[model samples]
Target chain A: MKKRLYIVLFGLAVLIPLGLLSGSPAWGEWDGAYYKKILGFIPKGIQNAKSLNAPLSDYTLGGTNSITGYYLSAFVGIAILFVLFFVLMKIFKARGKSEQSA
Target chain B: MHIPDGYLSPATVVATYAVVAPLWVYGFKKLKASLDEETLPLIGALSAMSFVIMMFNIPIPGGTSGHAVGAALISILFNPWIGFISVSLVLLIQAVVFGDGGISTLAANALSMAFVGSFVGYYSFMMCKKYRAAPFFAGWIALVSSSVLTSIFLGIQPIFWTLDGKPLYFPFGLKVTFVALVGSHMLFFGVVEGIFTALVYSFIKKRQKVVVA
Candidate 1:
């Protein structure tokens, strides 16, 4: 199961660049400009949205090719998820051990 | 669907967070109980799959695009709560590090794409367990269900929060949101999710049996 799962993950990661083929954003995930163009004004809240400056905003690194940025994002995201689960497992294991000893 | 920050009203944000907080707590407990040495790698891999799968955007005939959530595979393999928590973790990473989603709307996004998607897929699979195509049905219905909830969240903004005839947040009404978001999912992305879930589920199960044999 683990082996097959990783194989699928790797296969999809290899095709990650295909995700960038669509220039159009997902519906309702558009920028403030979209609202301005459609509704003739950007929604007040959206226009003044307190958006965080994400490190890899839209999965792009500054001054890098899009495909490179995408591959890097995939690797980083997968790594982060694996690390997170690994850490959580360790924490849970430690807690279980402590409780058993107690 | 990843609802960006500021797409929802403050009231909606607070309401979604309030509703999801207890679910997160309960789901976390369930996740911890389910996790151990053997299941760790599997769960981790599945969660990573969910994250990476979302990167594969399938553009529909319309201008926009969507992708499969992979919630059904995890939910059917383990349980809905585990699926929920795992996918929620994925969404958190997307929101914080990648900005694919919004921090303020994390609860809303999690509720729709994680909690709703997982539970819906799980129950649907259970109902149709006798059928060979159960995973496909589960994945299709789960994604469509998530899209429905997302449309509702976005659809209600204009009706309630408008100021001087201008929408304060998402401008689309239920009619438009349903037609665009839900319609697209039902037609395009839902099928993609169904195929993905069925293919992966059968592969894993088939390989596991061979290994045991």
Candidate 2:
């Protein structure tokens, strides 16, 4: 089961760049300017809403090559998830020990 | 559907966070109980699978694209709570690091995509376990359920909140949101999710007896 799952993840990782082939955005997940162009005005909240500067905004890195960026983003995302789970595991273990002692 | 930060009203944000806070706390407890040496690697790999699968973003007709969330596979294989927590963590990473979603809308996105998707997929698989296509239907229903909730959140924005004849927040009403978001999912992405879930579930189960390193 583990080996099969790993194979699937690796296969998907290798194919991750295919995700960038379609340049179109998901429905209803568009830019504020899309609202302005279609509805004649951007919604107030959407227009005024403050956005944080994400390190990898829209999954694109510093360079213009999107395929490479998407690949990096996939690896990075996966690594972060694993790291978080490991951290959570450590925290849980520590708390369990404390509770047992109590 | 990853809602951006300002798409929802403040009231909606607060309300969603309030609803998700307790669920997350309880879900974390559930996850802690389930996670052990034997299951940790499997669960982590499944969560990573969910993240990687979402990157596919299959293009559909009508100039929109979406991806099949691998939530159903996890939900059926393990349990709904773990699926929920796993995907919620994925969404959090997307929002904070990739900017795929927004921080403010995290609660709402988690609710629809993680919580609702997991529960719907889990129950659907259980009910249809007699059939080989249970995972397919589970994935289809899970994505559809997530779409329904996301549409509701996006659709209700303009109805309640507005400013001086101009709509505020998400401008689309229930009708448009339901048609565009839900309609697209049911027709295109849902099938992709269904097929992926069914194929992957069977693949994993098939190799269980092999025990290859």
Candidate 3:
């Protein structure tokens, strides 16, 4: 029952990101160093950096304008959280079992 | 930053290997001591987890996506050295199996991601776990901070202080990309990493389970 709450949290995390991605402006080009179902977010600096060949630090990398990125981030982010919660819960359960047996 | 073979001078490579070899020995010894028979599966699981987690690439604001390197996770599950070994395996797999990184730079990548990233991040995390907020902080700090540190290590030219030569440009395009790549990862991933690591660690702590490693 407790684990379910964690799952719900994970789901919510991903949904917000997906909504943002679906409503973004920069999702047009399928190529030009940013194509495919996976090549998700393109920071403004990174776009310029990749094109201009500037130093990485020279360009600022932020996700303030990224919608798909937020969605993807949330999904994977929450998945990781699920793993954590599951493992911790199992640990707790095992300890309880051990304690009662002892 | 994946340090390709030709980019680093042979001397640099040898020196790096020198620093890395002793740590390898020490980590092996540590593994031998703390690792009990009951934890055999943990080692395998850690290795598998390293291999698997790294493939799930997350797209950044830029068109490219970066995957979690898994050094911190391995360290959380086992001793840092064991995490080091496990991460090395993951790198090797990426190079050979996935064709992601170059084969020549394996040791350097391992040194940064596993040896340095895992141990430093993991130990700091261990210390941080005493407080209620530490779990989230530790996870965020471990992955995000390690991402930056590894980027610097990869980008910084070893010959910055050469006395006889004029300033070499030593263009670090990949290194630069690495920072942007890893830095972005830290900023974005930290929030999730903190939540994930804390909850996961909590689970393991709750179960009295030591990740079989």
Candidate 4:
């Protein structure tokens, strides 16, 4: 099961660039200008929306090819998830040991 | 649906965070109790799959496109709590790292996509376990259900948070949001989620004597 799951993950990651085929954003997840064009005015909240500066905004590095950035994003995301789980496992194991000892 | 910042009113954000806070606490406890060396790799791989799968944006007939959540497969294989936490983590990464979602609306996004999607998919699979296409139906209905909640969240903003006869937030009514978000999910993304769930579920369970929760 583990091996098969990894295979599936790798296969999907390899095809990650296909996701960029659609230039259209998801419904309701549109730019503020979309509302301006459709409703003749941009909503106040949307216009003044505050968001953090993401390092890899839209999953692309500055000046890099989109496909390369996408592949890097996939692998980086997968690596972070794995490392997170590994750290979680260690914490749980240590807690279990402490509880048993106490 | 990855609701962006400012799509929801402040009141809505506070309300959604209140509703999901306890659920996240309980879900985290459940995850801690279940994580171990034996299951760590499997769960990690599954979560990675969820992240990778979301990258595949399939365009429908309309100009807009959406992707599957992959929560159904995790929900049926383990438990809803595990599925919820796993996907919530994925969403967190997307928001903070990739700017795919919003920080203010994280709780709302997690509630709709992770909590609702996982539980609905899990229960749907359980109910239809006797049938061969149970996973497919579960994934389909789960995604559609999540979209319904998302539509409601986005739809209500215009109705209640408007000023000077102009919507202050999402700027769309229930009718429009329902027709767009829910309608698209029901027609296209839901089908993709169903197929992905069915294929992955069968592959993971094939020729294996593994015990599932």
Considering every candidate listed, which one attains the maximal DockQ?
A: 2
| Candidate with the larger DockQ of 1 and 4 | 4
Write the residue-wise lDDT of candidate 1 on B134-197 in tens digits: 9999999999999999999999999999999999999999999999999999999999999999
Candidate 3 chain A, which ten residues in sequence have the lowest lDDT sum? A52-61
The true-versus-predicted C-alpha distance at residue B66 of model 2, in Å, is 0.9
- Model 4 per-residue lDDT tens digits across residues B1-213: 999998999999999999999999999889899998889988898899889888888888878999999998899988899999999999999999999999999999999999999999999999999999999999999999999999999999988998989889998899999999988999899999999999998887863555553
Off by over 4 Å in 4: A97-102, B209-213
The sequence of per-residue lDDT tens digits that candidate 3 reaches over residues A1-102 is 134323433444434533333221111212324322333432232232212221111111244445544444434433443354345345655665798899
TM-score of 2: 0.97
Fnat per candidate, as a fraction, reads 0.84, 0.82, 0.00, 0.85
Identify the superior model by DockQ, candidate 2 or candidate 3.
2
Clashing pairs in 4: none
Give the per-residue lDDT digits (tens) of candidate 2, residues B1-213. 999989999999999999999999999999889887778888999999999989888888889899888888899988999999999999999999988889999999999999999999999999999998999999999999999999999999889998996788988899999999999999999999999999999898856756643
Q: Which CAPRI category fits model 4?
A: high
- Say which candidate scores most in lDDT: 1
Sort by TM-score, best first. 2, 1, 4, 3
lDDT of each: 0.93, 0.91, 0.51, 0.91
- Give me the displacement of residue A2 in model 2, in angstroms: 0.9
What DockQ does candidate 1 have relative to the true complex?
0.83
lDDT of 2 by residue, A1-102 (tens): 788889999999998888887888999889987997899988888998888889988898996689888988999999998888888888898899999999
DockQ, Cα level, model 2: 0.85
